[model samples]
Target: MSSEEAAPLLCAGIATFNALKKSGAEAGDMVVVQGIGGLGHLALQYARKMGFRVVAVGRGADIAEDALRLGAHVYIDSNKEDAVARLQSLGGARAIVTMISDIEAIAALMGALAPQGRLVLLGAGKNPLPVSAGYLVRGERSILGSITGTPFENERALDFSVLAGVRPRLETVPLERAAEAVARMKSGQATFRMVLTMTEKSHARP
Candidate 1:
């Protein structure tokens, strides 16, 4: 991987990788990756390679194709359907790796967990996340936050990524065009991960 490809792995890759490791889900178990942006996309790939049945939850149909391509066995468009019901229909997820910061949206997904399920949170929202005590106690479900891992863990993630062919979808721009890249990112027009390179060459990918 080039510098651009390696950049996201250092941050989003290690973050999602650590989150999934904390999930306590075993192989063949159901795992849902909520949100299909930078972190979520990498989570999907990691979850699938880890041998879990991957489900990707995101807004809009536009992301469905990419989600499926990324390794999700099923892609749930939250805007068109009830994600909880959909997840339930497939037998509740053993672990849910969430990458979005919408507190209410995150709260609503608690019901989609199977017994002893774990909801690994990677996104941090300003508002408090509302979760029911009964829900956790009854099903033995739990929620935990995860950030990037230790340096050794990061190395493990990188090794796994290389062995499993897991990579971030990147849109690279030269340092001279950093302002343009920032604008695109702010507008949500950036495809996935955007890297600002010191070199004059760009590495924009599909």
Candidate 2:
């Protein structure tokens, strides 16, 4: 893998990998990835490769195709359909891994989890997460936060990526254009990830 490929694995890759590991979801179980952007995209690939039935939930129809291409068995458009209802209809998710930080939005997804299922959080929002006791007590569903891994775990994530052919979809920009890249990322215009390369010219690849 080139630097562009390896770069994301170190950050987004490890984060998602660790989140999945902590999710308590087994192979053949249903796992939902919400957000379908930088972190969620990689999570879908990892979950599929790990043998989970992957479900992707995103806000637009535009992302549906890419979500499927990235290894999701089902893509739920949150804009047009009720994501919680759709997920519940599928027998609920064994684990729902999300990078979205909207606490209200996160609260809404709790209903989609199967009994004892977990909602693994990878995004950090400013406000407190408003979770009702009934949601946790009645179904035994739980929420947890996950961050990047240690050096050894990072190596493991990389090794797994290589063995499973998992790679981040990336757009590379010259180091000189880093500010432009940052601007695009901040504006949510970046397709997924933007890598700044020291090379004179930069390119994009799958």
Candidate 3:
């Protein structure tokens, strides 16, 4: 559990990201993680703490800056630059931890991955992945289907998030603003997370 009632925003995100970290990251590895928002940004921080050289791909410079501040070695503005080639230039990545399942994005990242590397899917989109068999065969690469964080992992995520000050830059909205917060998250506009706060007494949630 998180420290504050509003903290579930980052709490949920930290959970998923850590699972990806545990699955594919190692000390001193080059990592090109895709999608730097919501759960994606938390993944960047976890990657950095794991001693990986992280390259975060996303649309906003603020998100990039936040990633860098959180320990990412570099941040690629996917909007202005070629996302695939940008990741490609990073050489062999141990794994591609992605939250974007767009047809082209998935294809590009899979192709750019290193031999024996893994490409884990973390997106919540309903769109089916458009991948070619060649992408998986060439490098002996693997794809992983990861689920949301577990209670055990969530506990660890909270500890790490609190100790490391891995604050997910967020805009806390009241219950009334819940719709707006959801919209922001849905539109890919929420920087790191969208917290919906309640005015209930402290320790309100049992």
Summarize candidate 1's per-residue lDDT along 1-206 as a digit string, tens digits.
66678899999999999998899999999999999997888999999899999999999999999999999999999899999999999999999999999988888987899999999988888999888899899999998999888899988998999999998998989989999999998899887989999888776665
lDDT of 2 by residue, 1-206 (tens): 87789999999999999999999999999999989999988999999999999999889899999999999999998889999999999999999999998888888887899999999999999999888889789999898999999999999999999999999998999999999999989998787999999988876687
Q: What local lDDT does model 3 show for residue 192?
A: 60
Off by over 4 Å in 3: 9-11, 60-63, 183-189, 200-206
Instruction: Locate the minimum summed-lDDT window of 10 residues in model 3.
Output: 197-206
TM-score to true structure, per model: 0.97, 0.97, 0.80
Q: Is candidate 2 or candidate 3 better by lDDT?
A: 2
Per-residue C-alpha lDDT of model 3 across residues 1-206, encoded as one tens digit per residue: 34442275335555555655755668877777787666676777777766788888777676666778766798888778876676677777788787775756766666668777887777656767777677678877787777566678766776776666555656666777678778977897665666666743211121
Pull out the clashing pairs in model 1: none
- How far is each candidate from the true structure, as Cα RMSD in Å? 0.9, 0.9, 4.3
Residue 176 in model 2: shift from native, Å? 1.1
Collision pairs in model 3: none
